[model samples]
Every structure is written in structure tokens, then in C-alpha cells.
Target: MKLKLYADRMSQPVRAVIIFCKKNGIDFEEIRVDIAKRQNLTPEYAEINPMKQLPAIVDGRFKLFESHAILVYLASSFPGVADHWYPADVFKRSKIHSVLDWHHSNLRRGPTTIVRNTVLAPVLGRPLNPEAAAEGEKFLSASLSKIESVWLKGNGRFLLGGNQPSIADLSLVCDIMQLELLGETERNRLLGPYKEVQQWIENTRNATNPHFDEVHKILMKAKEKLQNPRMKGATNEGGGSDMKRTLHSRI
Candidate 1:
């Protein structure tokens, strides 16, 4: 069965899933959804994902959403590669699941909100409110401290009880990459306080993942485009004027 993934190139969760597929040698097709254009919100996309979120998938006739769920599904679907990435032991499996759940509720939201407010919004020619940016920074910094304490408590290079990478590492890597793309100033501010977290981020980035280069290239382009003022408004769909209005109104 051919797998089809609906994703935004800049979305960290999407990249995380893509990296998993690449590392496991899973064959799939990517269908880009331009969130800046509100493409995900359109009825056509809503039919596939009612929440209008990126990184949804269709494996043959079966449809799925949520990056973590997709990761578990992919691992179980290909058991040959499961032992290391998604262990079979009950306790080990539970540990992985716990971290993933925490990722969804905590780690994932902090850096993402900060990057969107401080980096993506301004690059898209949308004015960033100073107060919101400061709040995002505060939230993200606190989250990083917790992540360092929880995951980096041991001297292990990988998360959980393993020498090799697992679903926990993959999920965390995706979230960490968002902070890395936030320019030097913001990236340092977010990552500097947590020494262990910084080292883990580097380890994950250097690890072997089939989609590493492809995902990295996309992120690099996004960072570059966002930093260039002259190109911001012209590059985005509808010049991002409508998105700016929508985001600001929500704030």
C-alpha cells in the first residue's frame, strides 16, 4: 500500500514523521499543504483532517492523524525495524509512551508558539506583539529546563533506555529543530540554559535518518526566507495579509 502524507514543509511534526519514514525505508508520497495560504482550512483538506492540522496520513485506505500516533503505527506496521525504535518490552514501551504524551502536552507547544510569534510571523510581514513574544520565550525556557531534567538525567545519548534512537528521540528532535530554526539570538536564549538538552539536540541532528537532508534543507530555506525582509511578503501566499489578520485577531 502506498502511503500519502499531507504536510507543511516547515512543520516540525511533519518533518519528524518524514524522518521516521526515511530511516525505516518506508515508501511514501508527500503532499504539501501551504498553511500560510490557509490551504489546510479549506473544505477539501478538512475532509481529510477535520482539525486542519498538518502531518495527517492515508496508508492505503486507512487514514490517520497526529504525528505520535503515526509514528507508532509506522513502527508496528514494520516490525522488522521495531525492536530498537519502538521496543516490545512492556515497561520500555510504557516509558516511551509516557514521554510522547508529555511531548504533545508540553514540549511541542512551547517552542512552536515562540518560533511562530518571534520568527515566522515577522518574516511573513505580520507584526509581532512584544508582550506575546516575551510570554512565548518564558514558557519555552521553562519547558526546556524540565526536558533537560527529565530526559537527560542519565548519561545515555538517546532518550529512554537505549543506545539506539527510538520514537522518543524522533519526537523530541522534531520539536527541538523548531528552536534551532529561530535564528541565533532566539535559539541561544531558548536552548542555552539546558546543557544536556543542547547536547541531545546536536546528537539527534547528526544521527542517521533517511529524511535528514531533505528535512534540513526545507528548514534552512524557511529560516532564510523568514530572515529576508524584502522577500517575506512576496514569498507567502496572498502576501500573508489575511493570515496576519487572523493570527492577530486571535491574540
Candidate 2:
């Protein structure tokens, strides 16, 4: 059996995983799980991911969930995946892990919460919460400042002085991309202050193009769809090439 990826590009982490697989030329099939439709909450998906998350995977009999875990698994398991993503060097891998862990509480929390409260609330059947958005902005601003002062200051195109983009780079950038749904003026206001962070976003995108752009088309589509009050719901489809082959991978 070929590896099966359960995902939806509307998700930030899901987009990261998809871009990683594409950049590494990993062969697999993507099974899209529509959150708006609540497909991920169904019993069938529960067996694959008890947490009922947007991105999960089945590699032969082994099942995995959580975007960062999946990225590390793929980077280490797949023959096609390059070592730079999750390097074998014990120290380097640990450093990368630190960034990934730091992301959830800092960078990921901000943008995800803000996006949900602002534009994404209506689609998710949620109410706008300016209180939560205000809090989220605090985290977002702090996260950006940390990135500028600590990570980007190293004079590398990617995070942690990596010449090439790593799994951490992809993961964090995808989270920031959620800002694309905001109006240009608002988006610029938030991101414009951090010149290095802005440039890092571009660098990561350049490192993994066409696929990065392809996977993120949903953001633009959603932005457009949200403008039309008449639309009830939008379609949630998988992104990436079919590119299937027989499954054989490590843990």
C-alpha cells in the first residue's frame, strides 16, 4: 500500500507537511479531511487520529498525527527526504526540535487565534472575539520580535542559520501565511515592521515554490469566498500531485 496523507490545505500545518513532501519528492496520496464538513470528527478519522485533527497520516499500518511529528517522521523515514530537514546530527536535530516546540506556544498561537477570531470565525461557525484577537496580537508581536532578534540575525536565508529551509522554517512560515487573508493594509501593518521576518517569509517561499504557491491557493480562494455572503460553504479538496508508489518507509 502507498502511504496515505490525511490533510486539508486550509490548515497551516497541513500546508507545511504538503510542501515538505513535495519539496522532497516523496510519493504518496493525500486524503483531504474537510473541517468545515466535520469529516475529521467522524469515527473513521478517529481511528487514524484520535485527536481528530486536520492533518494525519497512515504509513502502511502505522498511524501518525500532529504536523511537527509528521514532518520529523517523514524527514527521517523517507528515503527521498533530505537530511537537512531533520538532520542526523544529534545537536542540530535537537535545535530544530526546540524551534518546533517553541512555535506552538509563541508563533503558532498568535496567528492561528487571530485568524480564527477575525476572518475565519464565520466559516468555522464561530463568533468573532476581539478580546481573543487582542491577546493573540500580543503573542504575534512578541514572536516576530523574537524571530528578528534571535533567528534571522544570523545572516542565513533560513532559520537557525540554515542555508536551506528546514522543517521548522516551513512550519513557522505557513503559520504566518495565515495573515494573507487579511486586507493588504492590515497585513502590512502587522508584518511591515519586521524587515527580516518579511524577507525570511519570501526566502522560504522561494526555497519551495510552485508547490508552496499551489498549496496556498486555498487561502486566496477562501478570502474571496468570505467576501460573498451568499455562499453557504466552500469545497475542501486535497492539494499536491498524485505521485503514488508502493509504501516502504522507516519510523
Q: Best candidate, lDDT-wise?
A: 2
Give the clashing residue pairs of candidate 1, or none.
Answer: none
What would the per-residue lDDT of candidate 2 be over residues 1-251, giving only the tens digit for each residue?
88899987878999999999998898889997777567788999999999988688899999999999999999989897777888999998998999999998899888878877886665454689999998989999999999988877686898999898889999999999988766567779899999999999999999999899999887776554545434423323222111000000000
TM for every model, in the order presented, reads 0.86, 0.88
Model 1: weakest 10-residue lDDT segment is: 242-251
Per-residue lDDT of model 1, residues 1-251, tens digit only:
67999987677788888888888788889897888678888999998889899889998788899889998999988646758788888888899999899887777777777776766675456777667767767777767777777766776887863677888888887777777557777677667778887777767767754467667676675565555546557765445554454333222
**Each prediction's Cα lDDT score?**
0.75, 0.81
RMSD vs true structure, all candidates: 4.0, 7.3
Clash count per candidate: 0, 0
Model 2 lDDT, residue 107, Cα? 94
Off by over 4 Å in 1: 230-251
The window of 10 residues in a row where model 2 has the poorest summed lDDT is 242-251
